[model samples]
Target: MRRWTPFVLLMPFQFIFGLIYSWGTISPAIHVQSGWPQATLDLAFSLTPLGLLPAVILAGRALHRLAPKTLLAWALTCFTVGGGIGLLTASPVAFMLGYSLLALGVGAGLSTAACIALVSRLYPQRRGSLGGALLALYGMSSVISAPLFDEINRLIGWRPSLAALLAVYAAVGWLAWAFLPEAPAAPGRQTAPLPLMVLLRQRPLRWALVIVLMATPLGSASFATIGHLTKAIGVSSALGVLAVSLMALGNGVGRLGFGLLADWISPRFSRAAALGLNALAALLLLGVLHGYGVWAFVAYPLLIGLAFGGMAGKLPALAAHVAEHHGEAAFGLLFGAFAFASFLGPFLSAGLGMHSALQGLALCALAAMGLGLAVAR
Candidate 1:
């Protein structure tokens, strides 16, 4: 079971991971098809993280009772049904509702954390390596899916493209059911989840979340508005779309690399490096604004994606350090904070404008980095 369950489970979760971040790729199609305003489209897309937040919290709570098969079952059902609704419905209300259900399936319900938790149990000693591999795979979906979505939506259109993915995921999910045997429990798997209040009080996790809150806006903003970045530099939309894929590739690399770095070195070093990368990316964005060169536009996502992906990649230890045996749930709380980034990124971009938004992000990174200097009593 341990020899192959991890590989068996990887396929379905990879498909789910792509869905969470597909907004940047497909939002333009929905906007064009529905004639919806950008704000309305943003709201509908942002529901992904919003939906993921509460569902992850609940999934963490239910870890004790839910069998792996049962959880995987709900994850598939919710995702496909919701995706079906979103595909068929032209109505805004219906689309939003379906997207929310998709979010539920993939969040804590049957998503990344659940699958990663299973693997963590499977290879307790190699949890970091395996978990980071999973995260990198999660990043790979965006790499392939972005350009795939861009081209397919251009050809058969979003409806058929979405339908095609749903079919593929269903087939892969069947493999998970047949081959994903129940993982034996980890040695201390029964430890109680830390109280939310207590979880919040830990210095490492607290500063990490604060870092997530502060640093994410820049990366999120870049991702959400990537097309505009290319446009500003007088480049083609094709390049803009391709930039997204590069960002995804960078994301995968960053997550895998930093996770191993944390294992090889220390969480503090990995975390600080991620923050520095983000701060540097923010500065690079500022330079892009002055029309430095087209390469800056290309480098932006790759660099920032590394930092942004590293932020989460380096954290399994930090979360485990704070919450003891309940790292999955602790990680859930960290995941939820990105929901705020979805809203804040756009708000900052709109209110503060592009230049100020990046500046704010730079300041946020510095603020988070300074936490390392504070005396821990």
Candidate 2:
């Protein structure tokens, strides 16, 4: 394979996100149009992560044995079908199922299995930077998706916008599968399949896992909080929408910026600082939640956005390190476990509610900080 082949493969990956997850930015608008309460939309959004749990674990195992490109292509097809189903129908159950399908495809194909394979095999020297750039690209989807979807929904409604996304996911997946080369399997350098429990037993490994788990609530709190701030702070819906784009910008910046830091500094240091910043950001939210207009409107998203965004690039690098320290075979399982935590964070944060979630997430951040310190030491 040419050296630049993997980089080219990233295009479809970015496009899938632009269509699928980016659609999330317009979720608020969808809520209004469907006559469904925010809770219903939350329920639908929640399905993605929830559905990811088994999907990620299973995908990891399958990729260990099968060709990743083939699997990715099939998963992308599933994503298209799932997304298509949800877009065409307004049934709450159907919508949730569609999201679950998309989640399954993404979890199995994009987020865990294919991503790990791509970075670990192709860009060994530039792990942090490459991973961060990839994640940052994913974050950019929100910026592109939010206003684009908002405009699309205005013109044709949510259903058509979703259907358009479904088409994109399908096309991108097919192109990637057709062209992306499979890395040749190695001999002798074998990994033993360790159970999740055994992998979690190592202290450093546990801390690394905890970092992702801890990050989940932090990221989720931010996602749910957008609407809350609009209501509580009395910001114009326009400003609230703008905040979402800013958050996406912060997310991309964090991924690329912190990722570069991870390469220059130690992953341990980069992760610890990120978690501490997360704690501080959550604290900032708590302090400013009651403040008027600008502070209430601007402060939380800016900080939370940075903290959550920074984690994407760093976490995978951290995971790879932890896996290297543990064993290579353990990488898939450990990452799967981490994905489980990622899935849990949003719902847990949502359950924490507007005001209280910040405090709970702050504690999680502090705990992550502690774990990070232990890992560093």
Candidate 3:
């Protein structure tokens, strides 16, 4: 396969990468269909990271033994099967089961890990810029999809919406699979891969993973539960779609801006700035949002989105640096922390009452800010 094929195949990958975030857009409809509580819906959102991060771990391992196209094939199959399950409406249990399957597929990190490995190997000299571009597209997926999803869900209902989306994913996945190539030979003195447990024992690597664990879920859990959040704050729940779009905008801008900033300035400064933004967002969640109504919602998602985006962009580069030659260790350790946070965040956010849950998140972010600064030093 040509070197440029994975980059082109990325278009189809992008089509499905952010399906996990669609919970905010479609949860309302799902609630109407199943008569499930907001928290249960959010639980569905939490499943993404569970499926995703583990898939990431598996994909990271599989990249050594399997071709990228093979992994992409697996990912596409998961999405298809998961989408099929999600379309069933026999009962509430069936709907939840379908969502669980879709969550598994949506967050499946098989293709993501495959694509990252392929790109990193094929474009070693330009991986940072290229990866930033990839992250930007990941963020952009939500921006474009949020409104489109809302409109479609509004018009056709969530189940049919899933059917339409699956059709698109199928067409796109077919192209992506046909074109996706394996990682080319890594151009360097190849070190024997280290044991993941041994790598985790190292202080720098361990700390790096902790940072990723803390930073990723700040806005995201709240994002997964956005419709409920708006309703709790006395606004129309549907307004959450607007918040999702803005958050995605913040995310895309931060992905590029922070990635570039890290290259130009320092990851330390960038991380610190990102952490501070997160803390400020927490402050909003803790205090101001209750009184001001919808206007308050605007500031919170944007701040959290930027902070989350900044860290998402900065951390992979940091992991690569901190772990040095241990790419697999980086994927398992640092990225694992990311996947773990994906599970922990929304499960807690939606599980708790809105103000209290957000308040807890606020405190966590502030604590993380202190740890982040200390680690940077």
TM-score list, all predictions: 0.85, 0.85, 0.83
For model 1, state the Cα shift of residue 189 in Å. 4.5
lDDT of 1 by residue, 221-261 (tens): 77666766678668778887888777777788887888787
Model 3: per-residue Cα lDDT over 222-274, one tens digit each = 76666677777776555667776677778877777776665566656767777
Candidate 3: residue pairs that collide: none
Weakest 10 consecutive residues of candidate 3 by summed lDDT:
185-194
Q: Per-residue lDDT for 20 in model 2?
A: 42
When sorted by lDDT, best at the front, the candidate numbers are 1, 3, 2
Clashing pairs in 2: none
- How good is model 1 by TM-score? 0.85
- For residue 43, give model 3's deviation from the true position in Å: 2.8
Misplaced by over 4 Å in model 1 are 1-4, 100-109, 147-156, 186-192, 230-245, 287-299, 373-377
Tell me the lDDT of candidate 3.
0.67
Candidate 1: Cα lDDT at 138? 68
Give the Å error, residue 321, model 1.
Answer: 2.6
Question: Best-fitting candidate, measured by lDDT?
Answer: 1
